[model samples]
Target: MESLLECIICKEPYNQSNRAPIILTCGHTFCKSCVHKMSQHSQYIRCPIDRKFESRDLSSLNMNYAIVQIQEYERTGILAKERCKAHEFPIVITCKTCNIDCCPKCIRKHLSHDMYDMEHPTLIQELDNSMNGFEIKIKEYLDASFSAKNRLDKEISELDHQKVKLKKEIEDAFESLMRILENKKIQSIQQLDHKIKEKEDFLKQRLNDVNEQIKYYSMHYDEFQHMKKYYKESTFIDRVVSCRNVLRELNFVQFIKPKDINDNKLRIIVDTTPLIAHSIGSVSFNEKSSSEILMEQLNFQIEELKSNKLIYNKTNPEQKLSLEIQSISNFLCMSENIPELAKMHLIECCCNEILGYSSLKLSDHLKQELSKKIDTESLFDTKIQEYIPTLRSKLKYVKGLIYSLEKIHEKEWEKGLYVLHCLIINENEYDFAELYLQIALLRICSQSFYIINQFKVIDALPLVDLIKRYTKFHFLPSTMCYKQVMSSLRFAYKFVENQMPDFFFPYFKTQYSAYLTEMSSKATENIPSEYPSELLAIFQGLDSSDLHFWKDSDLSKQFLNKVHRFKEECSPWFQALRFVQERGEELSDFELAALERSLN
Candidate 1:
């Protein structure tokens, strides 16, 4: 019974007569038919004892002769019995994947070390344990990853909590500062009130004197008439002229006056340094705001606020202010419409900061994925010590940026916004785009919006894009300018409108048809005419029925004429194009029914 061969799959003994050609290894054996099938699958003999990923060598497995030798005396089982080659024991044979031996006591021990255990243990666990150290390493990596993820979650929670708290504190600061703004303006408010009060006091005094004289005159008129002749000598009884000058002066009745944000700036636009005259509006007052006054007030307020304070650097005041600007959204626009502008500025800056942070974090993923594609030398750039003239010159460029942003606050809407627009129009460089967007966000979109008209060139379509980006602002491009830009760009203005609806929506908002008509009527006579033909054709065709088309359809020319209202053909296709687009619906059930009815 112990001299029997074991099956690779079943791991049990079978009779010699039933034995098949097999390979043996580690005292385990499997049938040749099974081994041959397994060999075809793998380049190296994968241990059936432990079905780990391994190659199978077909040349090494000999099956037919071994099976034939065992079965030669299968009719006489005693003759077929063999001795163990390594030790003096009755022999059993088997394939390499599973072992069978005559020595039962040693078999149990050999089975204990087997990659796939037969009894008292699990085969899967032995196979797993058989892996070279990578399993432990991979397990450790996964564990560490989970721990890190947990830590990251906690960190994110803490950061979100901090963000909320910071936001609250920032709001509290804004609210408090707004109160200060109102409080400070009380002085100006009082000054106007004082002027009105002074005028009233002067008028009242004269009225009181007039009443006194009138009362005296009523009682002493006859006596005074009697003395009029004697008083011709102009002695102690000299008649005093009634103070009618008071009545005349009192005629200057003061009217109530309402001031805008510009009016409040002197008192409310607090700063750490005295604001330069340039910081104020285009229109000047009798008195310019003192730079010292602003500096002292802003410093005190900054110090008054919890640890965060607005301060001026001894060397670079602009850099310091720019940095602090990230702290507050409230900006002092040189215009009267400051509160509205300030609200917009604050929201934009906060959003921008969040965007920058998010993108910076995501940038790492891009670097990892694309690092293989990137150049090792260029990216690593080990030639730092050998800074040639070209590199040295480029290195000097950051100073120029510092210079640019330093005096940025000094610029007003017209000059500043134009400069910003000109700087941002590049489609080539990302760094340029970043700088442009940053500067644009910092500077409100009031003035550059107008200056876009100055560049009526067909190629500078980016101006239209910029206008689209800042849609909330009032920007009215001429119909000609729009035509030129869209025509030159090979895309319709509606393409931009559709892609960037949020930006253009405010300009084309509802309930403004009257205003639009009024503005159109009032527009200058020489409405420039760079007619884009394709746009006209589309609008004309869309106005027609049956949104389908054919090869010869001059829909392009049709769109041009129809859109610009230049001309339209009397074709049925043109008429149909107008019909479907006006409905702005696809071929629906009702439309289908209408089409069939029309055909019938």
Candidate 2:
């Protein structure tokens, strides 16, 4: 089975010293010199002879491991142990490398050997004695741990059973006691009623006896007065009758609704107001896909910057005024003219062909204007006001378009997805802030409003509110959603890196690292037994955890550069998140207008 051939170069019988060669694309042998020469060009090394590529660090190639096995049979002259690669003696060591096989004799020779026993003549004897002691201790600890765990488990099971039994018993006893108490109260009420009636009757009899005597006296007095004939117009008997009036009374009780004797009809009601931030704009879209839009908005100042640049001679050599960059800076708008400009621009783009017919038909004049130029103004339909009514309709159609695009992306774009990674730049100031806030509101509400079946392509990212929320929470978002968000981020990250790096600082760094780690762990944990190149790629650069650099208040600028590098390193590590990185909120004209409608 061993080599029955000769070496190509030497033309000699193959011996253990010489080995079979692996071919490379360069028509060279797979010898160390051949591979080493190719290493200087790239991190990946492809066999020039075979044109095979290993997309990993070439330095990490295990040449010893990958090389053909020993060319000859073992030299069987002596029963001596195999020699160590380094010491060239009978092996007697467990190598310092994470784990390696070694024999007893060579183990004591190497000073770096992790398990070497230099002090002892018979190291194996000493190791066996130490191992026996270690084994005894381990057994003792394990035995104690097992006993405790078993007792706790058994007790927990018993307690659970007892809890169930006691709960049932208590409920049954409580019901029976309630019935008994109710019966006793009813009987007591009956007895009290009988006693009250008897008392009332006895009292009535005594009152009647006294009343009869009084009646007789009154009659005798009247008769005597008549016989005497001394009565005037105001007689004595008439006066006495007028002075005292007879009294009649009956007891009444209040009525109540049926619930229980212990229950009351009173109810409690509370109205509380939430401390909600006033939104710049809101969306009728679902939250699932609006995350991308949210990220873009987050990266900028939202509304366009209107800084009036005023430069002057510093030394007053020429008192000259420079420039005035102006727009109404107030948060409460000065007028509707500015928004009109935005709307006009948006309409001009006409990016949303899925216009709502009803909204367009709101006014005959506007409908005629929009219909005249659908082809020319698709991407630039900036006026968001006129389209509010039909926003839902247009949104419905556009979303359908998105779904269609996803279903047949090849037919539609030829490219997997074509996205504007840098859309809607320069977000600053109250107006821009308002625009962005609206963008956020639009993003947050977009996916929440739409259902899975209602829209063609479901975008669950770039909703401004959701993006803000997600950034604050640091989450592993949906794959499609993340793709869209990454597009938004790519645009915004440019501005942040160039202009607003000071604002986000290390927060982006921290979150970026955390996101990569979480994504990688998920990839590794869910990796299949078979090859998972896609997942493996995601897991790369995730071994290192996020390194914090900023304190609560005092942070230097040095941390910023580090943070930038960290994010850059982690950016390509997760392909799942990257695949959908650029797909974002594709809002219809009416949908954009719908946001303005809620503003009022």
Candidate 3:
């Protein structure tokens, strides 16, 4: 009975004040304060008990007088009933027409109006029906609230985990930088100590020589004084010649003075400008919204596909490749403001797709896709056009390379060679540093054909010239292009060895020898300790009986070992070449085709 008088939401007993029971049109009652909170100061109110919406204003809603009377009875021993103002009697009947409660004496005021007794059985039955399943509704509401709270808690926990992970990454990054700085510091100090020791040793040796000279001069002076005091004039005259000879010899002696030591002091000059500019590192809030982060993640997946890590399989290989190209095209259309690295990766992927396909028509498909999707003007900045051209021009160069490979595949060697030569001649128009390696490889491939077919001893000169040029200007033998270049050169050497005895001997003895010397000097410190065996084999061939430039067994072996260890790592193409070479067989036709398409 006490529970029936309380509001289910606030669990407080209804009273005449803010907690006065207000009834909704749905026949559910709640305290006035809870109703106000539910209404949120609006005209409409939704019953929390039944979830039924009411359009009537909060002030217009009827009060639950039955619960109010019960609450009043609980507070006082006697039931609190309203008395008529006109006749002092408890109100019993309610007038329907006037919508008011009236006593038996005051019933004349609303006589003609319809009226009903306050204790009608029908009214009590309607009230009982209103509260059916009330507990079940309350439980549902509680369950929904708990679910929302659990979702919020999960989000907060994930955020905390991310914070900890980011903190550790920051610490690891700084720790790596600190380790590098410490190593640099130690190296610098060791170099300083070595320079100081060399200078100190030279100064000490000079001091010892100067001291000996001073002692000899003092003894000669003492001997001259003794002869003058104790010997006759005749003995002194004979000794004078010897003394003059000694004086002449002493005058001729070259003495290194303390002041003569030039200032060859070593001092370390550390440049902190780059460090000041970049600082240690930085952490800031990610400015991208949720939608933008999703876009970047999608773009990253496309990049993986472009690198050929994710395979796209279909019955027709050409169609499969075309679909992959179209995927990139679609991605480019949606995201106009892609990063520069992303754009480069896209171009590289497209090239790879075209190269992998057997059909010549896919190249045309790539061109069409690129033309439709890429925005030329927006991609290439006018200010930096010299360093990097527009994407269109880059694609054009790629198309030319593809065309040359096709011609080579068709056995149209002259046409293929012509196209490659034209590209190489106009290489400066493109990004030279980026494309130089490709052009160099193609030139070496062209020269390899001449060595095989023409059988001209002079054909090997261009190969030697090409190597000398690479060694002098662009010396990065650890790279895949460098490895391929050396491999091709070695093949050329083997082909003409029986015929041309000293074809490459002169260049290897002079220029090549000097290059090896330079590499050997820097091998211990700057250069890596592992290299491809193919690269090391080239130098081994140079140490033939005729051209024994590498004949110093002990020194040459150690130098070759260091160069071998310089870079044990190899790119995919280098590994393929090694696989073929190990079996004592030439590259397969497919391998050659792939080699011609190599961009890196």
Candidate 4:
């Protein structure tokens, strides 16, 4: 009994602190500190009793409150003896029929009940066997839950990583397109400016020539008048004769007019049809990628489990146990069921023991049968055969819609719109269809905003329609949170509605209210200026060549010390610098230069 309350690893009794008993998924209890130490050596904990690997976080392990209670009872001598309420006689016997402890005087009341000595070896062995069986079932359930959770967690993480990758791809595609458009715009403007300058120069030269002619003609007229008024008749006659030849020349000259100036207009006719058709790059999904394949498999498994039901009802005890097991298995698949499920398992075990029936063995058998039902491909196929084709078809159609949307072609835009409308309207009929639709719509809105802001080739009508549909469908407060969804929505709103929605700014402000408050408080507070020991170590280890030339001087140490003491107070900046310093030779010169420039 004493050994039962002690940790196998440390051979110490359980306590509330460091020696607190924690049960692993394998149903083995050990001290918290011992488990923590074991977990440090590996990603998984290998149960010392069964040598089974349980991939559970040490901190998440359930504390064995039962053991704690028992230990406390033992410490207080509460389990040492029990007295009958009426006779005040010591209770040393258990009424097996009633499943209760009783004194000798109480035996008269339970005369027809089957009684056993408290210290009877056979009774003790029976109790231990029953407990062992219960433990086995509990372990099986826990293992299944842990396995399902781990797989789900891994898949979620992979999808998240894929989401980030896809976002970057979209950004890169748009950035490249924007660059091309920018270059074309600059070139067009330059050409237009050059043509205008050429036209202006020609007009200026022609005007100057005409003005010279006018000045000459005016001076000739004035001279003729002066001769007529003041010169001798002979001189005036000679001037007239000289002017006669010039007048004949002027009559044949034909002065420049507006019509003769070649009034051709320069216009830029941009044929955006071809650019719109081909310039925007397409987004695509590899349907057969490992992640996609895994996702499909997981979806199939989840669907199969959800559809599964026990063939029998609770009238039969064995079937009741089976149903309980099935129900627990279903609950265990969910992330939030661990605490509740643990308590339920404990209660079920206690109930089974008190009932004096070996439901544990029955539960174990049912568990195996359930496993086979779930695991056997032929059985699963037979079970879900009716809806398989329909499910596949729906998935394929959704994939096609996603592919068309990703192509970013003007022709496909309507098709994308149609897909979104259908998805939103029939969202209830499909599993994960709403999620896919939401993300796709958000991406479209984001892309539309990019196109309008950068090139204005694509129409904003579709973007506006999409945003309206998104809002009408109440797609805000999406599974993808505000931070992710709002950025795209805000940009789309600005382009379409010309103003941000009331929800946008407030959502962000409220979401980051705490962070903003912290920042505001920090802005007014004095921060520590000295570098932490870890940072100081990193600074000292940095290569001398990477440092400035002044580092070679005798004042280098003093300079470094002074800089460390008072140069800056931003912890994040210091951490980033320390990270860079720690990387040392791993970072390239260009990367280092970029980091330095960023820091500056």
Name the top lDDT candidate. Answer: 3
Q: After TM-score superposition, what is the CA distance of residue 473 in candidate 4 from its true location, in Å?
A: 78
410-433: candidate 2 lDDT, tens digit per residue: 322111011100011111113222
lDDT of all predictions, in order shown?
Answer: 0.38, 0.37, 0.52, 0.51
Query: After aligning candidate 1 to the native by TM-score, how far in Å is the CA of 322 from where it should be?
Result: 22
Each prediction's RMSD over C-alphas, in Å, is 32.6, 36.0, 25.8, 41.2
Q: What is the TM-score of each candidate against the true structure?
A: 0.21, 0.26, 0.31, 0.28
Q: Which ranges in model 4 have alpha carbons more than 4 Å from their true place?
A: 1-90, 114-129, 148-178, 201-205, 208-600
Tens-digit lDDT track of model 1 for 534-576: 3224333441112112111253233223322311211222233
Clashes of 4: 0
Q: Which model, 2 or 3, shows the larger lDDT?
A: 3
TM-score of 4: 0.28
lDDT tens digits by residue: candidate 3, 99-211: 78899997988889888888887656654675656667778888988877775676577569778998898889889888998997798789878877887887788778778
Poorest lDDT segment (10 consecutive residues) of candidate 1? 543-552
Q: Relative to the unseen true structure, what is the C-alpha lDDT of residue 77 in candidate 4, on a scale of 0 to 100? A: 59
Scored against the true structure, residue 304 in model 4 reaches a CA lDDT of 42
How should the candidates be ordered by lDDT, best one leading? 3, 4, 1, 2
lDDT of 2 at 69: 34
**Regions of candidate 3 where Cα sits further than 4 Å from its true position:** 1-147, 205-259, 266-289, 309-600
